[model samples]
Target: MLSRGGAVENDRGSFREFVEKQKQKGTLVLLKKPCSLSLELAGVMKALDGKPVYCDKIKEVPGARVAGNVFCTRELICEYFGIRNEELMPKLVHAINNPSKPELVEGKNAPVLEVTEQEVDLSKFPIPFHAPKDGGPYFASAVGIANDKEYGRNCSFHRMMVIGKDRVAVRILPRHLEEFIKRAEGELEVAFVVGAPINVLLAAAISVEIGKDELQIANSLAPLRTVRLESGIEVPADAEYVFEGRITSEMVDEGPFVDLTETYDIVRKQRVMKITKVHHRKNPIFHVLLPGALEHKLLMGMPREPTIFNEVGKVAECKGVNITPGGCSWLHAVVAVRKKKDDDGKNAIEAAFRGHKSLKHVVVVDEDIDIYDPESVEWAIATRVQADKRLVIKHNEKGSSLDPSADPNTYATTKMGVDATKPLVAHGKNFEKAEWKAIKKEEYV
Candidate 1:
């Protein structure tokens, strides 16, 4: 039953190309079970444990099939960017700093416009209910696209909850989209792109200077081809689904939705999006992102790695960075550096905090330690850190709003950093882990 939708021949720029590439690599999983959008969050979360595989087999929603966990791991992201695992952060930082302009094509040539809904109805798609606290079924995988005459075009992920057949309540933070909406006199033209390519998704999440077009960043990672909508908004030509809409002046209660911190965000009056035109490819596979899951954490955290790396580079030879899932991948970070001076660890800790202001705690480790491995990072902290000498703390710092402990009104909290790098006097020999001689496992078995 799950194997019904075979490979859809795709152009070079379509998201289906990436899916087909992953499928060819044997990393895509097709689930055959029919699942309720609200009830299946846990099942999808469980299926993505420690692996980044594409899963499809949702049949519960009307007029759609659903898939999830498209960018859950570094390996998958590296695959999409055509880079090696170790080159991920540097490459991202470079691409973000230097972006390529996007190429635009006519709307009639786009696959997303292959079918257009005469009447705008969002309920026809299986936008998942990710958590019990969520107010309604929300579009968790959407990368919203909007344009400003000055800013050109902007793409970012904004949670949209389906409130009516053609209405969605969008949680708009003070960013490019909000700025663009403010620039627009009445209603802001927008496009909620579902199932965008991996590059586009990452580009949307990055924090860049205002007036910087994220589509160009997507093009820097890979050549991004866009199609002009009837509304004049440009979207990735190969997106699975595109909802051309407008951000209206009307406001609605839009929260209690799970955030990146895996906490229920309080309800707030947010702007509403009135979808005008719904366009999609034939037999489109709906992309659903489980809120507060690994997918959410990775997408939110990985983009920050470059910022942290670039900041720490000024003070030390920054090796790598890992935003731990335990820290909600937003409020905590682990930075690895090749210790040159005795204070390089401490310097890196301060630099990292500066890189991401929302960080509440940071741990700096030696080059020998693997930042991705929690146990290794913990070991470095245990063996090398002296609380009185290595600890750095700041009071009443601006922090993540998702942190339950922070003052919600001000988004302020205490922040700390730990210098877990070994002393320079030791010459690193004493800190090395004991290793066993290599042997053939086949012989022993």
Candidate 2:
């Protein structure tokens, strides 16, 4: 286990503190060259997809800084939470199960409210034009927080495209935010927070009940403080930037942006948001999440791991779950379980699908197999799996929108589950791998 002591322990829920820790550890890359918001900054971000990057010289926005790939990998996320890889699922599950309210601070003491501009101009910030096919400069890292009369409050990620000085076309899915908008009669007040802490970011991406507040889950993960905006929308007090906005009845075409699968999403008429105010801390750092990149995939997929683990646990003694990045971290997953019966693997497969509706493929392995290692999982599949008996397939199933091969209109695809667990009783062939005792190489040499 990694050490849980030091600066990280002291500043567990502070985004700036985490960045500074990464800098001290030499894991964060600093870009001294001036970069442009139009493709160049995103290009650099993509080029270094799995490493934390910071750039202070923005050609478009003077005195502004941008950071990317901060939590791009599972290891980085674990480091942020001061946990090991094996502990992630339990931590997430605990947070989801036991959510606690965050402390509310006044606007006067909130760091985010240090600078507030009533006359909003989004173009003045360092929003990125990620790819050539993108509709416009996007705030891909923004987590929108909105409240409803019935649902109370909802926090979720909404990709927004800058359309004017104070307006943005936001892609609103038929989820909690949409429900909140409808409840508010097609106009809902929202606060889009950028450069939030890892706990808040992970909690926002989680799919919970509509009325359940994600900020509470974030607080459970780590102590969180929030400040209520003038619009009555509460946001993280330590966030880099907060855009006080309203999702209006007006709509505009908003897409051609890269999705989780690195494919261009089709244009659709989306809701328009009018930013009434903008607030940021001194020397604010913008979070630049390049569309369809590792950071994007992890944020979208990691939260689903706990759900899959929970469902699989109902059927079998679940050991671990890995949403592989090779599957775009959305469509494919590997589950490890302590197989008690011959049918436990199959039962786990069914439960895993029930856990995450968007999962297209899953492989069930014995507890001995390391689900995190692709080679180990492949070895298990090759050795233990007999396609004729262990393969389970479902045709024309509802799948993820990120998968390009799925039906464009319906998003339906074929799903497969492989029971790769070894039989309890080996009849003719040995299923276990032969291992030698541990040896000291240095002594032998």
Candidate 3:
């Protein structure tokens, strides 16, 4: 959904191109389902299905496509941002801290009101049943365009549940739309736009402490982006659909299903709103995100990575960071650094915790080791890490409420960090890689 100059791709590719690329890569699997909505189908799909395969077109949302595994893998995320996997974090951080504000353009065909549906019905949209315990159909792909309290314009992503024909339960967080909601004191005006551009969706999904109005960040990410809309709702003009709505104080049961971290979460008693209207194009295409899939983690985790990088940069030459898979996209953090001082690791540890607040385990390693490599990081810790000198463990630290293990509604649990960089020593066998030879790909492949 390009909003300004031309039809710039929201991501590296278009919705059609995405399918083509997946086809070329021989990655996407085709399946035939009759708009399956059974609770068991969703569970089976998650438990048994492979990576980002297309569900083809569902009967309910005709001409619409649903793809999962969007961010479950690094290659997919790299594809989305048009960068190498190694460059994903830095690119995201750069884009987040220095986002370009959206430019308004005159357009009567603005998606928010274009073919606006007056007789709204949530059931008409292909809302998926992610889990058996899930309360209702969820629009996992929708982008919640939140109105900033201080600035009156900002947008973020929060899971919304279709509680009614004209309403949904919005899940906004402190660093995201929830912050704006509080600024408006319980009742916040918002625009819930679904069937989004992939890049715009990603920009909203993988963002950090960025100011209100991330459409600009998304636009800058896709330099050729052309956004044009005059209805006060700042969004890509080419996006398939955009609906203006509000988050109300009305509360309802939210969830008791599995989350992105691959954990069964019990999100009970949440605020739900009544949907007033919906807008979409004729035979508009609908998109759904795989709840708790790679794309979900990437979109959710990558943005937070920048937050950690910014905070840790103050203390060390933090090069890059990644939230490991074992951490379920929220629990663990792996930070790559060019350690300048002996205490750089500790500073990074504190900065990481401070940056994310919910991080439990942090590992700081030299740039030589791949933070994404479990074995490599383990080797660094085994050889260079010293518990007495490098390990920093603090009790009763803040943690994630999404973490069922953590004591919720209270203080954070114990968190720890290991400086996996080799100790700077002259001759004490302090830190050195054991003898190993690099092998050529031809020898193995």
Which candidate number has the best TM-score? 2
For candidate 1, write residues 123-228 as lDDT tens digits: 6777777777789888888999988887788889999999999999999888888988988975799999998887888899998888888889988877777898
Ranking by TM-score: 2, 1, 3
- In the range 1-445, model 2's lDDT, one tens digit per residue, is 2134344555636778888889999999999899999999989999999999999999989998888999999888888777887888899999999999998999997999999898887878999998998999999999999988877889999999999999999998889999989988999889999999989999999998889999999998878889988888889998999999889999999998988888899899999999999999998999888888899999988999999999999999999899999888899999999988889999999999999999999999998898889999999999998899999999999987777888988999999999999998889888888999999999988
- In candidate 1, position 25 carries an lDDT of 71
For model 2, the superposed segments whose C-alpha errors exceed 4 Å read 1-5, 8-12, 443-445
How should the candidates be ordered by lDDT, best one leading? 2, 1, 3
The collision pairs in model 2 are none
Better of 2 and 3 by TM-score: 2
- Provide backbone clash counts, one per model: 0, 0, 20
**TM-score attained by model 3:** 0.86
Q: After superposition, how far is residue 234 of candidate 3 from its true place, in Å?
A: 2.2
lDDT of each: 0.82, 0.90, 0.68
